[model samples]
Target: MYDSGKIIAGLIVFVLLVTFPFISNMGKASAKPKPSIDTPVINEMAVKKCVEPKEFMRAEHMQLLNNWRDSVVRNGDRIYVNTAGQSYNMSLQNTCMNCHSNKKKFCDECHNYMAVNPYCWSCHIQPKEQPNEQPKENML
Candidate 1:
């Protein structure tokens, strides 16, 4: 009778273990809505293809800085419209602040969300600014 009870208890434990995953609602709150598989699909040729413009760099990404300067100072606008034919307008102010502000709040939130490892703080300084002293004075 003791052996039978042991076998019944073992069977109950095995059943609970196998069904635990299905019964658990641990992930239900955060689960993303499933996309409809029956939705009509459009062919690739039917959709307009937009290629991101090649990022310009003169020396070590200097061109990006120049572009930023031109967009901010010369154009007097933060938006850089790439008439070179693209679907989206690249905004310097929006993109920069989106990642740099509050370090952990906005930037880290999305970085952690997408599992991307950023290397900006390692080599370059944040809030890029002009040198306070003149180059000639530094040489003296």
Candidate 2:
């Protein structure tokens, strides 16, 4: 109890130092990060769609791509039949990446938001630019 004043002052200083960042950011409006999905390839399409619906694609696109990889690479199956009874070619480069050509605009936007690094491009070859040529639908 001899140096109680000094001990209390030191404790108060430590608490403020620990909580400084939280207190400083309090009541400050944070900028909402708007992820850009609209690109030239996505625009100008008569029918803007994906293999799956927008909600499903947003949540499960990685899983669907993984399934496509397994089907094409492991099982030697080149065709992927979606839930809507539509068959699409199971090639990521030709089918998926063809439409989503701009990796920075489409893929990276969502990936960066969620902080996920999918190892898709590591193995799969990036699609070459086919400007002015709209990505053809997987019609069987």
Candidate 3:
């Protein structure tokens, strides 16, 4: 019992030190980012829809992509039919990126926010993004 007070003080200090990060960052989390889908192809579409429903894609896109990779590589299958019975090509670049041209806005925003480093680009090539050119007004 001679060192009981000192032991308690050291334990409190250690607990505070361990919990400093949680205490310091309380209620300071950033808002979830909303990815932009303002590509010309999507703009031209009458109905703005993806290969699957928005919620389905948001939750199961990784699994869907993995299945697509396996289907294409292993079985040489290139067609994907959605739940709505609509057929789509399984090419990520030609199909997905064809509409989602703004990678920084569409893909990077969510990926960065989620702190994920997806290895899709290792085997697949990332589509080249065209620079967003603001329309210059003609000076009279």
Candidate 4:
């Protein structure tokens, strides 16, 4: 009972400090970015479809890309058969970039929103300014 007043004041200060951030940021969060798929290749497709389904691609694209890299580089497998039984060339540059040429709009949008720094550009050349003369489909 000796330091009851001091203890109460300290507890109140600690609670305020802990809750300050949440209170300040209430209703101020930016909306998540929706990646665009408006490139020429995508637009020209009579039936616009990705290698995998949209739901699967959204959640597991990174894992799939990693698997592709391992398969292509390590195991020397260059083909990917999706869940739908369609075959595709497993490539980030030729296959993916061919369709998703608008890298800033398509790739960077969601990546930046998620605060991730993918090392895709460290070794591979960025295809922003490079023109693909004839954008060919990777799927069979």
Candidate 5:
């Protein structure tokens, strides 16, 4: 015959274990009111597409870089110009490639090992390319 005390203790423990999660979550449910479809929201900022910095370089970002390069000021004056010839005031410190040198030092070493072809070389110059190369027809 099973002990009566033992059976009662087992039933109490089982009930407590089953009820623990519900008891813990009861406070959270009462704390916040759920938002419905009719709720009014105010958003002032315009939505903009986000792109990674490396991916941005791979895309048609060369134009932006060119603009920045042209707008560099030798003096203390802060003057900037856009592609459309509009003048503005902004200071561009350096170019992107100034930091990322090679695949091993900056890009390729890591990406090559990972077997990922970063499209950055498409728009930007590769690290290994020579500064000057004669045309094939001219060479011959």
Candidate 6:
């Protein structure tokens, strides 16, 4: 009990050091990370909609994609009928990646933010990047 005073001070210092980050960041305005979804392909689509609703797709896209993979690979079912009764080819490359061609912008955006390493790319080749085509001007 002779070193009780020193023990209490050391404990206080340890607690403050452990909670330093929380204390320092308290009440400070932090920038909200905005995941980019505005790719050229998506913007140019005639029907700006997915097989499912946007919120559903955002939250459960991995699960949906897994289901599609299993159906196509295991059951030989190549068609997906959404809740809206619309049928789509069960393909990650041709169907899902068709609209979301820019993996860096669309897929990577949320994945990187959430620190999720989806194994979809390990088996599937990423879609080729769409080249930016500039309009040609004719000289008289």
Q: Residue by residue across 3-63, what tens digits does model 4's lDDT show?
A: 9899999999999899999879899967879888988899999999999889999999999
Q: Indicate the worst ten consecutive residues by lDDT in candidate 4.
A: 131-140
Question: Pairs clashing in candidate 6?
Answer: none
* lDDT score for candidate 4 against the true structure: 0.86
Q: Give all TM-scores, in the order shown.
A: 0.26, 0.66, 0.79, 0.77, 0.24, 0.71
Q: What tens-digit string does per-residue lDDT give for candidate 3 at 1-140? A: 67999999999999999999999989997688889999999999999999999999999988999999999999999999999999999988898889998877898789878778788877776666754643132111
Residue pairs clashing in model 5 are 103-107, 103-108, 103-109, 104-109
In candidate 2, stretches whose alpha carbon ends up further than 4 angstroms from where it belongs are 1-41, 127-140
Q: Is candidate 4 or candidate 5 better by lDDT?
A: 4
- Full-model lDDT, candidate 1: 0.45
Model 5, span 104-140: residue lDDT tens: 4334434444456544445444444343752222111
lDDT of 2 by residue, 1-140 (tens): 87999999999999999999999999998654454547666676778888889899878888888888788889999987888899899888888777777766577566666667778767776555556664342211
Give lDDT tens digits, candidate 6, residues 1-140: 77999999999999999999999999998654465657676789888999999999978988999998899899999989999999999999988877777676677666666667788867887666645632132111
Candidate of highest TM-score: 3
> Which is the winner by TM-score between candidate 2 and candidate 5?
2
Please give the lDDT score at residue 81 for candidate 1. Answer: 47
Which ten residues in a row are the worst by lDDT in model 1? 35-44
Each model's total of backbone clashes: 0, 0, 0, 0, 4, 0
Error of 2 at 130 (Å): 13
What lDDT would each prediction earn against the true structure? 0.45, 0.75, 0.86, 0.86, 0.44, 0.80
